[model samples]
Target: MKFTRAICIALVIVLVSSLDLTSAAVEEEIKVACVQTELIPCFVAAFIGSQPSAECCGKLKEQQSCLCGYIQNPTFGQFIKNSQNVFTASWHLEKMIIHVNLTQDNPMPLEAGRTVDLTYSVNWIPTDITFARRFDVYLDYPFFEHQIHWFSIFNSFMMVIFLTGLVSMILMRTLRNDYAKYAREDDDLESLERDVNEESGWKLVHGDVFRPPRGLVLLSAVVGTGAQLALLVLLVILMAIIGTLYVGRGAIVTTFIVCYALTSFISGYVSGGMYSRSGGKHWIKCMILTASLFPFLCFGIGFILNTIAIFYGSLAAIPFGTMVVVFVIWGFISFPLALLGTVVGRNWSGAPNNPCRVKTIPRPIPEKKWYLTPSVVSLMGGLLPFGSIFIEMYFVFTSFWNYKVYYVYGFMLLVFLILVVVTVCVTIVGTYFLLNAENYHWQWTSFFSAASTAVYVYLYSIYYYYVKTKMFGFFQTSFYFGYTLMFCLGLGILCGAVGFLGSNLFVRRIYRNIKCD
Candidate 1:
């Protein structure tokens, strides 16, 4: 989650999309700039309370109207980070003050060559006070500081909403109609006689649907870790929304690391309960695997990326102190909490129940067409989830790689919800189809079906590297792909868990309601 935290910080800091606005003909027409380049020197002098040079003064006077235009421009308004900075400054020192005496008490226009009397006062501040200032200053205020890609966000939302509604409508209508037909047929003697022969598909295989996946221990570990991560992310997002976090540059990273470390209890509980339900007695092994898998993977990837950052002398690199802190937090607080949760979960969890009893002999799965096969279904299953998120993903990629500003967390949170909804819907629908096709190996299928979204994410990342980003060099490329891989890995786990849980519940409910003999 450290890399995810880094990505999240990188996610909401800015929102500038890549656009090619300068054309050859437009460039040819502008002989001089709208704002004079020479005025920069004058602006610097004014910043330190000094008078402008003669040339600078001439430029300032010449561009006074243009300066006013720039100030009025909304795009230029962001240049001043905050107007309240004067009050917030650490020291209250007056560099200089001037007093003027006018002839009239009321405001009046100045006559040519009019004489005015002026008084001056100045206060000095100590070096210590000046050195204590921590806030940033900008030479010129920026435009569109809180800018969001509203159009893109809205478009993505509409598309996802349409797809989700269509899917839900189709599934509900079809399932309701089928349930009605099956119920009516149950009263007919002829239909009842034919059911045994007709039920050779899903009905015949109900016994195996609840069978534990082959790698139950590892799968349980993945699901638990993923569930913990999902909850951690949701909490962090809520914190940001409520302003508990979102303080500054490092806020997201700091909050994410702390929240994720503390949430290890969730992972332990989920893993222990799942392992117990699957009839596994090795609680310690389950706990170790659940706790270690993602952390080790993240640390390994982060270490490599940090080494690259150190090589390039980039501040983005995680410091030694920060790494030590993270390690200590994980080892001391997280591990202990996980152990406690594991014990509680093992004690609290009861024996598992299946809607239908399993037979002593396993049923053979009939042959499936290419389209109905697991590989094809898994590949196709990711499309909707990917579509729901691809637009938001582009913005996220732009923020990380292109050094753009992106402060649209609200939009990001919305997109995230839509992605989860889509992942669950598609995976459940896919699971239902696979079951009807007489394929009961749904455990891995459900996970891979939803986790397949990561494949598209990785593929799009490749496209972005070639088309969207002009980034070069071995270090930059490696860092991009390496962090991307981690991001995909985390995404897979999170999304796969969503699909697995949803499909698991759906299967249980449907089968439990059926009056099996």
Candidate 2:
């Protein structure tokens, strides 16, 4: 256990150090002009094939004096000289004439109230890579408008805080009263007599609650995969939150893939440990499933998407060599690491102790009230989490569909924290009620309860595609819904793990602390 923890800590330190260095290098190397900043709106309008706003035209006029100087700079000249590579601007005005000259002595003239369609492009040339190509910037009309969602985010956060405080107050008060009542019974004989007459609440199902869940192997595998992904996502976002990981479009995907691959060991260890603790002997099978299931699913979908992009002759298609590299990374590097982790997990950690011993004969559970039923509780459990992020979801959806630059990692990190808190709290409260109602089958229920939030996320995507976005065409539709499915799959796993682990800890702690026979 100590070795594993040390390895994880070392990996984190390395990633953070490298990221900080990379950020410093970028800041030192990249140079931008003051007038060029004004051209930002023009670039967005150009990229999205929209009419430049008056503000954009105004900036263009203001920067006319520096046009010649900008033309001399390689960074700026590349865009001006290679219109085909830089952007595809469409002229859609009734009467307009434009002049282009790199050696003109006089400054360029810009007239106000004239509309010009322009596309802007930005490319990231990594210090390590030599090849360079123009990358299109696809922000939508009225650039930088998405940042205004900060108000909605603020409102949502306040509401979440209020709800969290309310829940905390209620839980604390109720648990305190329960603890006091249990403490009042000083003698075991008195407690036994009281228990015989009217024993109630969560303690009533103590023995059954800790019984290894049915299909324990599969549950362990799922939770293990979820746990690994949760950690991976947290790390990735932390890097972004520190302003290190969001440099380019490629950087985001590259970082996530690398992190996901490296974290396979976590998946294997968690799954194997969980399976072993659950009294399962098929540790190898569990490890394999944990390693393969999510990766295969993601890769299969990506392969299909790449094939479609290639068929359409789209530049978005990933190259065959790239595909091979990705395959090797997963198959050779990640899978082997997972195997090693499984071995370590099996040997390093002995079986975990359950709060209550499982009986050879399972206790029969009483019928549950409708409100306490798994289906109802699961549905409600998901609502709070989904609600917490719904506001941020709008901005994210806009960024994906409208080709907006998503630079709000700080806001995203805040929303992520809120989602975690909400998922944990709701699941714990729901699980408590279920146990109190004598229902001990919380393995899948705890998972599905939290995962159900993804159902709402998908539904919102459908609504966005049909109502909010003007995206049309077979390719657009396919990409939107397909990627949405992948996103939901990941979200479900991350949130579900948070919920289950939180509730599991809560249940064990409460049962262990209580004065129960």
Candidate 3:
């Protein structure tokens, strides 16, 4: 039966080739040619058993007279005659239907040289649905809107509320006491000296707290890039909510590229202000690094993925023209905006604003408990933030990997805001602890603490790959993890920068009220 169907399909191909159905219109006077051209649609309808379009049916009715004549010709008649038991066609009330009847009750044995009939049918049923809504059938609303999903969102929201309250309590109760004690105006020198000696924790490191962090240049660049990415992600998500960007092919990617270029100034302004305030001497290098850091990282990943795709002959490979266009966009638009932003930032808000004057000699960082160490603090800082967004990550992963359409942008927006708030709160708390441990190097520690959220997310992705998804093979696994790595990298940097900036402000505000020499 399969062999018989193959022969019939081959015959249809041969017939289509002989007719030379070009895009040129078939004149009414050339009846044979017109019928042959119209038959192209019928051939497709019969071959694939799909519903015939209005155009296909209209052409069939107009050229109905010439169809029989062409089919009966000696050259084409033999194949049609051989396949007559397997193929049948009829038209009724402007509808074209092809039916192939096979006797299924009496199963035929498959043997070489035995002719078995193949049966199939094509029925064109009218539908009122518009062309734009053809994809509605594929959307699984129940799965997306399940009770578990809503519960997860609510759970995350509660976590945010809890974290917010905790942060507020720390600021109001703990900080207020510290402020009152630090701001005491004692007239007696001996009492003042006693109080100074009693001060232990954050106050002891005031002079060194605001000193420039190590690796000032690289830190500034990543922070700047992370700032740009944060803004870019927020803008893209809002646009997706407003524009239904998921409906169009490559729309999200195009929007990301364009928006990233337009938002380059954010990175430049941020990196520039940070570098200048830190007294960094390499201005040009800072500006360049801020501009190229994220883009180059993505480009390197994309280049590897594209090479793998090309090797596999997959359409996923990015064309060379697209690469050139992306490079041109960065070079012409993104790079210059970053440069302009850097200049503006350097001249505007780049002044040093440290509340405490740095001492001449660097303070030696004393050893603390294992839990209070920077590495431990950084690693532990991400837990609450990750918990806040863990469920959202599952939805996102399903949409990207499991072929589900993600339309819950409102949920996403809420989750994103929650992640940001939780990250900031958690990192600020971690920074406070580190400072209390007399660790003056809170800048990078704060950044890493917040950035550690991405580490958890990446680890979750690995677990999801092995358990939740059925993804296998080197090509698919590599692409999945590679893309996840890129996402986590950006996420880590964005969260890290947010954490550091929050800690920076907290440190500045608290110290501003104290008597720093």
lDDT of each: 0.68, 0.68, 0.76
- Residue 456 lDDT, candidate 2, scale 0-100: 93
Residue 452 of model 3, lDDT score: 94
**Candidate of highest TM-score:** 3
lDDT of 2 by residue, 250-290 (tens): 88888888998899888788777777767788887877887
Name the weakest run of 10 consecutive residues (lDDT summed) in model 3.
Answer: 77-86
Model 1 worst lDDT run, 10 consecutive residues = 80-89
How accurate locally is residue 437 in candidate 3, as Cα lDDT from 0 to 100? 85
For model 2, the stretches where C-alpha displacement exceeds 4 angstroms are 1-148, 159-171, 180-200, 243-246
Candidate 1 segments exceeding 4 Å error: 1-173, 176-200, 244-247, 309-317
Give the higher-TM-score candidate: 1 or 2: 2
How would you encode candidate 3's per-residue C-alpha lDDT over 58-124 as one tens digit per residue? 5444343223221223333211212222223222343322232221122232222334344333333
In model 3, the Cα lDDT at residue 203 comes to: 88
lDDT of 1: 0.68
Residue lDDT tens for model 1, 218-263: 8888888888888988888878887734326778888888888899
* TM-score per candidate, chains pooled: 0.69, 0.69, 0.78
